[model samples]
Target chain A: MVLSERDNHLIAEIQDGLPLSSRPYREIGRRLGLSELQVIERISALQDGGVIKRMGIVVRHHELGYTANAMVVWDVPDDQVDSVGEKLGSQPCVTLCYQRPRKLPEWPYNLFCMIHGRERERVLEHIDSIVASQGLEQLPRKILFSGKRFKQRGAKYR
Target chain B: MDDTDRAIINRLQESFPITDRPYLQAARELGIEEDELIRRLQSMLESKLLSRFGPMYHAERLGGGLSLCAMRVPQHEFERVNEQVNVFPEVAHNYARDHEFNMWFVLATETPERIGSVIREIEQLTGCRVYNMPKEEEFFVGLKLEV
Candidate 1:
């Protein structure tokens, strides 16, 4: 869906966050020269259109002692990736899971699942459980533990 | 964080209502006073427990672009490459991961074409080959971390 000028402005406003107030919409409406109802309806429209993926609390796993995060990638056969991906993604412990193209020779892994935990051993165990439960024990895979966050911020949508 | 806070975190992770009196409505559902809910939410944001609280956009859905680009600069030139790559505002975040392709960062651009242009610019500026890995399929994306 193409975003109107006002929609863009509205997105720019709430993307950071809705004001922490009793009537947050009213405040946002006030800033954008839109009524509270307009703001609510527009946001609903965006959500329906899939422009806004989700609206809620964004948890910081690192702050919550889930520092031992690992990106587990698997080189599953193309034919079985969809089923395997869904299986991996259905697990509660798996935070983010997606399929990306494999850059042959150097990066052979295609399916990626992000698992986070307070302990490194626990994260590994979770992966082990997923592999065993999903019947993916023999797949070629690699665990990439993220280190040193040099930059982090909300996406710039303007 | 106590039980109430934990409960609030878990509840809110599912969703925050979009309504006139959203806080009141949400607090009612969560079985907490609206004022208390607001206070806890504020406190969490301030304490950095919740990095952010709002709409997470889908760039592709918005007619833009998003991609996870990886690179392998020599150990000696990693920092310099990082600086050059990050100079572009399109680079949302960069992470040093344990792999041959060490420097991994996500690019969120205003247009789909910008992704390639930015990749070209980075390759030219840093002289390091960037492995552009856009998602072929998104199996799932639910970032609900129960505190």
Candidate 2:
């Protein structure tokens, strides 16, 4: 859906985040010369169109003591990836789960999942449990811990 | 963080009411005054516990292209390559991971076709092969870091 110029402007204005206020939409409307209802309607439409995934708080997991973060990659057979990925993604320990193209001759892992915990051993144990329970222990896997967080933020649209 | 703060973080992470007075609505549900909820949220945000509080847009669904790209740069050339790669506006979240494929970054472009060109540009600038690993399938895990 092609967004209007006004819609783009509204998105750009609130992309960073909404202001902490009782009536945030109303406050935004005041700034953009829109009615509170109009702002709500526009946002609702955007969400309905799948543009906005959800309006909520983005928590910093590290601050919550989830210091050990690792991106676990697995070389699951292409045929079994869908079922295995769904099962893996359903687990609470696995945060982000997806299938990316495996670069042959170098990168062999296609299925990827992220796990975070208070300690490295704990996170590894969680991964081990998932692999064992899901019958994915046979597959080749690797876990890469995030070393330095250079940047972590929502994709900038503007 | 106290019980109320924990409750706020847990509740707000899953859902934030979209209404005329959202904070008021949420506060009523949380059994706290609207002002208190707002104050607590403000404090959490100021503390950087909450990176942001707003709509989370799916860039791909919104006619934008997104990909998880990685590169393996030599230790000495890591910083220079990182700077060169991050100089592009399309580069979103870049991180240094302890692995052979060390440098990872999320690339977001206006068009799906633009993804390839950006990767090419980055490769030319950094003189490093850019592995454009776009996600083929995504499973919704209801990812929520419950504190």
Candidate 3:
């Protein structure tokens, strides 16, 4: 989609994510020489057109007492993937669920989901429940947790 | 771009202040009715074009452990492996990148040590090497899509 100069300017400003101020739109409008209403209208349009997915908070799971986090990989059958993935994605604990191409002699997973909890055991327990609920007891699976947080940010729309 | 869309995006890009009745504050600044501002926001969110409307936190400040991980799974077993990797709660985002390590994902943990253990568990269970390609240098690519 073609973007006007003003649209470009506005996208650039909020690319790093919204400003954490009560009058964020006003602040942005002030910098861009636009009114707050104008700013809001532009964002609404962008969102409507699928250019901006959604604006939401990226919670710090650790701070929220979700200490144990892990990437659980599942070896789902090709035919059963769509059904299984849909079911998995519906779970609140499974924050992210998507399919990815696997590398031969390297990677071997197609379906993936994310689970979190305050304790490692609790996280594992949740995983167990997911596996059982999904009838994946016989599936080959693995979990990869985080060792360090190097970087994290909302998608930049510049 | 039409005037209406331009106006909405322009507003979304700004940082909303953290205060009581922030929406009202925004409305006053916009010279529009508070209800109108809220209705617009609600409609945008309902449309699924916008994922969410809220705060974006600096995870590191809260002592969270995060890393980018990759695994090499045979194409024949791609479906199986993908399902296994995604089950973990720590895996925030997973992608099918084009490379020798086709499957890549990001993991965030409350403790750093758990990150290592999680990787180890995946390796043992999957019978594949979990190459931990942790971030050594940070590159901030602020790419915001302008619809």
Candidate 4:
């Protein structure tokens, strides 16, 4: 998508995240020499166009007591992946769920879902229930518990 | 955290109004002054309770490509391989995992084709196999870890 000069500038400024102020739009407009309404309008249009996925807070789950995080990968049949992905994604405990291509001989898992909790045991238990209820016991799977976070930040296009 | 702090975290996570006086509106909804709301948010950010507060952009929609890539590095060489992988500007999120595919990261590229080349380059540089797992289908799951 080719963004106009103005829109590009606005995205560059706001990509770090919105300002933490009562009138954040106003502050952003002040910096860009735009009216608060214009800022809001541009953001709304961007979102409507799918350029901006969402406008929300990015919380640190660990600090919020969600220390246990596991990325569960499943090797379900190709035809059934869509249905299985939808079912797993619908689970409240699943933070992320998607379908990825299986790398041939070495790697076979195609469906991926992430679950987060305050404890490792709790996360495991949740995964167990998901596997049982979702009828995924027969599928080959692996649970990779996340270790240290080397880097995590918003995507920077500019 | 106190009730007010918890309230701010809970409310802000779901949605932040897009308005001329967004903070004021949020404060009104939270039953607090605008300045106090902003102050609390700033403090929380400073204390690292919130990693970031802003608009989340969909990279693929914005003419970029993103994928989840993993590597299986020898335990002794994990740190060395990690440094090599992190040096790439496209690497967004990197994490160590306790599996054969020990190192995992997200690569955000300027173009979709760049994903393959990036993986190839990393494989050569790190001397390890790079598994590029680009999402073929995404299910919408509004992930809100309730505090």
Q: Judged by DockQ, which candidate is best? A: 1
Cα lDDT computed for each candidate against the true fold: 0.90, 0.89, 0.62, 0.88
State the lDDT of candidate 2 residue by residue for A1-158, as single tens digits.
Answer: 67887888788888999988778999999999999999999998888787887788888877877889999999999999999999989998788999999999899999999998989999888988888888887899999998877777777785
Per-prediction TM-score to the true structure, in the order listed: 0.96, 0.95, 0.54, 0.95
Candidate 1, residues B55-140: lDDT per residue as tens digits? Answer: 97888987789999999989999989999988999999998998888999999999999999999999999999999999999887
Enumerate the candidates' DockQ scores in order: 0.83, 0.78, 0.07, 0.78
Cα DockQ of the candidate 3 complex: 0.07
Better of 1 and 3 by DockQ: 1
> Would you list the clashing residue pairs of candidate 2?
none
How does candidate 2 score on lDDT? Answer: 0.89
TM-score (C-alpha) between model 1 and the true structure: 0.96
Tens-digit per-residue lDDT, A1-158, candidate 4: 56788998898899887887667888999999999899999988898887987777788888888878999999989999989999999999898899999998888999999899999999999999998998889999999999999988767886
Model 2 lDDT at residue B91: 86
Residue pairs with backbone overlap in model 1: none
* lDDT tens digits by residue: candidate 3, A1-158: 44577976887787655544457777888999998888878876666554553454334455445557677777777787777777777776776676654544455777776677667888888888888887878778878765444333343323
Q: What docking tier does model 2 reach?
A: medium
- What is the C-alpha lDDT profile of model 3 across B1-147, one tens digit per residue? 235433554565445534434667766777777677766665554553454465333334334566667777788887777777777777766766445556777777766677898888777767777776554322222212222
Docking class of 3: incorrect
Worst 10 residues of 2 chain A by lDDT: A149-158
Q: Mark the 10 consecutive residues where model 2 chain B has the least summed lDDT.
A: B138-147
Instruction: Name the runs in model 3 displaced over 4 angstroms.
Output: A20-22, A153-157, B1-22, B25-147
Alpha carbon deviation, residue A35, candidate 1 (Å): 1.5
Which stretches of candidate 2 lie above 4 Å from their native place? none
